[model samples]
Target: MTDDREAIVPVWTLATGDVRVPALAGDRPMTAERLTELRGVLAALADEPIATLEVHPLSDKLDRGRGIPLDAGSPLAQHLSQLITQSAKSSSVAAKATATGENLYRMVVPAKTAAQLGQGIVRPMAAKGVANGIRGAFVNSKGTIVDAASFVPVGKAAAAGAAGGAGATAGVAVAGSAALTVAAPLVLMAVAVGVSAHADHQRQQAITRITELLEQLHDQKLDDERSELDGCRDAIDKATAILLDQGKLGVSLGLDSAVHAIGKALAAADRRLTKWENALDELPEGKAVEIDTLTKSFPGVDDDGGTFRTHLELAGLAIALKRRVIVLQAVDHAQSDPGNPFENFARALKADQQRLDELESSIAGVLERLSALELTRTNSFRPVLTTGEVDRLMRAASRIRKLGDGVMVNSRATDVAIDIARNKDGSVVVFPSQPA
Candidate 1:
């Protein structure tokens, strides 16, 4: 017989080397080439069938870069705690919430913030002051008086201004229009123009791919949001009955929190759903873009009359279908027996947790590797973060930690099964579980 523990999700360590968080790219600030590379990487994942994964919550946060845990709490708990602590420290107090009540302990922040108001404001401001001190050391980046003698050289500024006039053009266009340009005769000047033109084509290609992917994701989000709305309505409906029921003893103290949570969760879901609907609604008329120019400008290219676009649409549709079907398929694959939502949700959650951990490691790796040698680099020294950002981050971490501790995890399902299994066939099977 298979052991109960055997089916439990495996919690792999998140040491520095254990999980690699691929560098973020795409419509972000990373260069078009860099962004395209990243898109290819992430797109590969999005394109493929998601692995049969399980996300077992770690019982503790990994210490430093080691896979060793901070405590018995899950990595999700640590991630949540970090998120909470960081948010608590942010200047905009309202900005730190998980928006939706993803965790039951989200409510504790108002009380905690009020309790620790003094350090909440002071530490962050101090951190900002230190950061500004360092940033002010730079001679190039805009801010108050430049004190950073270590910033860019004077002559390079002119060169950069000239280069920016040249390079920034394509970056801006790709960031928005994803325009495809053409180069001059084969030379340095030609190379610059050709490079920009090439990037523009790739940018359009990526945008088309991503926008299409996002649309599919948006549909899934829409369904999920609708599900969220339904859940909220159900919770509120139950709470409404409880509120009206004078005979329901000991319900007020408990039910009030539940109702409040349901209301808050519902409102957040509404806000996000509205945002998604709005974004989806605003999709630009992509048909206006001229892929024919790229086909003609390059010697080996062929138009094929929107065939690539057709293929993109078809791929997007297929991906959407896969996502719709996969949750069911993954569940079927994971379950030792068929048709269990709790097991499905649990296993899916476990895999998500692993993925989230991987993302954290990836981000942290980038942070810890910044160097003074970075000073000599011709690349613009955009601060990876803004001032007071650390305090906000720290507070978020703390809050996530608190949230982890607040909620209890258990199997009401197992309890029910145990109850049913104990009763004899002919005997009165007294319901051992509460008749909610």
Candidate 2:
């Protein structure tokens, strides 16, 4: 016996779908209201069972609200409706309602049946002006388009139809010359629009990447600046601690005072030296006659009486003795002179000037060391002072302290007196005595 068997096929299958309307063109996005209108139009034409109806908004997810299901007469429609209504009432819907690219409407039917519905029902509705602003396509389980259609704008359709009819007639009349001119601009405009869109998309992506990179660089630079500031603070703290520990906190101030004192001393010594120099210059010219008379004078008086020869000899002898006595007196005055004011002033000036030079040199050395530390801080984000650098700075502090001590000793010495005694063997002893 021969038996006839029928093959069974799955009712529900996966399909790729897209539905774009006129509102999605240009800068306009698919808003909620517009999506509802499109859904209503699709619902009126959907006579068969639809498995799912997914609506993707053209706008970003943040702007698009909760999803709304199509009010189609299907088994899943009531459950989807309830879910959407609940989601709309509550603000905390975790699931994203919309996506970016395309909206989908699927039917749980055989591929043949879906294709028939698209051509018969959907295309008829488009022809009747119900799907006027719609453009869509449906793919089968194999990811191939089962059916697709686009509702052309009335103006574009009319222009296309007119151009086609004219080109057909002109092809025979002008030997295609008139047709080429008319069609060339339209083709070129379409190509230009496509190229411009592509270029604009690429430019936006490049700008986004560049902006991200710039932001990263800026953040890194700020971090480096902060690190540099931290290093500077640390360096300053270390330097301060070093100074405090060495008991040289006021070294700079002491040095400054010493400089001022030395400057004053130098000025006073300069004045005294000038005065003594003037006195020395005047002494030679003003005392010349006195010196000459003293040279010719004698110590003894004349003893001869009345006779010319005897009186002359006695006068010569008296003059010779007086001259000798004058010479001896002058020698005694020079040998016992207390001090040469000119020499003392010159020596004091030289000593004070030397001290001034030493103080200035110390100041310069300190400044140079500080400058080097500053440059290191300036050039690097995080600078660590070397052992040599720390040692140098410590040495500077020591020198400054020594300078202060020397100044203090000199200042005290100026207010005191020293007595010097010579021994029999030419050795000398100095005893410092307080001023009365």
Candidate 3:
């Protein structure tokens, strides 16, 4: 018997970790090398023959503490919640990682698989050609796999009679949207009926492979940002503990120093946010002027690409710092509220999460404009543009684009999940729990 509780399918947790807040790479530039590493990982997943890929906001037991969710659409929810589209020619699944940018999810390329089956199935033109001919016939408009032949009756000559009948069958196979919608679920359920054991085995293999791929990924910048965010979380927790212990007597008990500590942390975060805002504000918007004019414009990159790299790096750092600052701001707001610290803090997570979204939107808008410059052509015919300058600009634009795409914050904070309870003296105790 198959263990229903057994996770036979692989679940790749792509997250920035801790505090359950929306954040990108903090204090690090997402360089071209970093972006290439990210794409390489996705390309590996894209090669997998995914049975069914579902993207959702990853939530850990800690995130849903005492039935209260910390996510409240803060981290990965904003992007993963968007539509995941499947590529007909390839097994690549693309998702809107940000409101304005698209990122690859996971899936398989049918064409690639068919090429591998060349000699095994038949001659060069037989198997490969057949697969190519029916490249997208199996997927519905929503990218769900469906049985194309299901639209017609089985074992009936009249259903596929010559000329008109065959033509109708092929048409339904290719563009029968209404019929596919009604039949897709039935096909999936039927396919899932008795393959539990096989599915479990495939899942185990996938998990192992994905784990290996993740281990191979090494981004020092992302690691540094994770540490910084952790420090910020620790700072918030420190203030929270003080408030819980002292209650209204915090000032009289000589613990008022904790308020100063909180202020310091908040100030540091604010400074980072201001720096990023000023730098980003300096970037020119693409829609503001003609593409030709934008290309001719110089936003401060030197011939060696040094200045452009600095700007891209700062933008990345800002993307990360901005997110952490949002959390700090929320905590500051909650701390000022004249209510239970625990309740107020939890409410602030959801209430103030919108700031993170706004930050992402602003970054995305700037990156979109930069992208136009990268794509603009500058040949000898257009003496106004140079190849070397455009190359440097392209590198900067690409890095900023990746930074603005936002990091996929995986749900792995259960270990840090804290629980709050009332003591006999009406005081509150926040303890960690290892949720099952």
Candidate 4:
């Protein structure tokens, strides 16, 4: 069974009976409201048994949040890379979702056999396949196939022609189009600052700028849009106030609170944007946009480019503003965490920044794809992607690219290796290791 729709709640299933669900943020105990929400999300995916629901974490970088072709090069991305490589099956996508993008991995497995795959029980599960199921697990998000050298089923000749010189050398023997590789291991120099009145002022000023930007971009058209921006402003204000009031003694706790609040706001806005895009997708005019594909040809679909471009424009403004605020909140903070707090902070900062980068890249990819479609068309009789749409997309991509490049601040030069250990129950446990 193939499903190609985006859902607010991300759900994935292993061929095994086990279904993966979203873990509550941090160690927060589940509340009735939270439980209710979880139940609703689960109910939405009940039609397919053995599913996994995970929300892609939000980040300060732009390219992070949007789902796209998978990166096969990064060590961190290896798990996903391996999953696709082993499975020969496509469909690992991070779906469009509210607050943050959600990923729904589709696996072809029987409902009965208790396959322990995708549970992270075994490091890089591909080494050991399920007792009875496909060799590799399948993953798809929002109708975009994960394109990796190892994932493509076709041989080299076909893949080479399809990729059209877009392929990156992954050193793996597999057929595919251009491969997206992760940037060099991000070296995040952790920083620890003693909370000072001056730092507090800087925070306030930063928050004010974010609030002003929110005000400037405030969309009065939809209550949902307005409310999202308003909520973001309030969250920053209240969370910042709490963080400052906590004094140096409680700076760690305060920063945590602030990050959480800001992240929530950003996520809420993202969700709203996703909903808006979904509505746009339903419109009769615009053509459907697909970022992941093997061939250079744009797929033919009845999708509205005007509405879609507008959605990207709005999202670009809103997400960029909030991310700037997050970057401000993250850098040069005093944290009381154990074991080289600076490195820890740097690691966290890098992760968030990378997320933003991924998001921006995805946006750029969308615009680029659309722009290419407009340029490469069959007939000159009234193009499907109008000139105005192409121009807007190009401008948006340029602006978004600049924002993504400049988002990171105070990053250190050395890369740090992260030691990730899984508990007996298959929950991942991450801690700092020495620098790589």
TM-score of each: 0.16, 0.15, 0.27, 0.28
Error of 2 at 14 (Å): 37
Tens-place lDDT per residue, model 4, 152-222, is 11111111111101111122222232111111111111011111111222233334443444454453553
Model 3: residues with Cα > 4 Å off, grouped in runs? 1-237, 240-347, 350-357, 374-404, 407-436
Which structure is stronger by lDDT: 1 or 3? 3
Identify the superior model by TM-score, candidate 2 or candidate 3.
3
Misplaced by over 4 Å in model 2 are: 1-144, 147-182, 219-436
Off by over 4 Å in 4: 1-223, 241-306, 321-334, 375-436
After superposition of all CA atoms, the RMSD between model 3 and the true structure is 23.6
Query: Between prediction 1 and prediction 4, which has the larger TM-score?
Result: 4
Q: Compared with the true structure, what per-residue lDDT tens digits does model 3 show for residues 1-436?
A: 2222211111122211011211222222233233334323432333221111211122222221221111212111122221111111111222222112221122111222212211111111111112211111122223443331111111100111111100111111112111111111111111111111112222233233323332443445533433343333334334333332222223343223433433443344345445545654565654233333333333332222322333333333333333333333334444354333223433454454344344434434454444334334423466666776577556645543443233322222111111222222222221211111
Summarize candidate 2's per-residue lDDT along 19-135 as a digit string, tens digits.
112221121223324433433343233332112122212221211111111122211222223223332333121023311112232212222322221111111100122211122
150-183, model 1: which lDDT tens digit per residue? Answer: 1100010000011110111110112221211110
Steric overlap count per candidate: 40, 5, 6, 41
Error of 3 at 179 (Å): 39
> On a 0 to 1 TM-score scale, where does candidate 2 land against the true structure?
0.15
lDDT of 3: 0.27
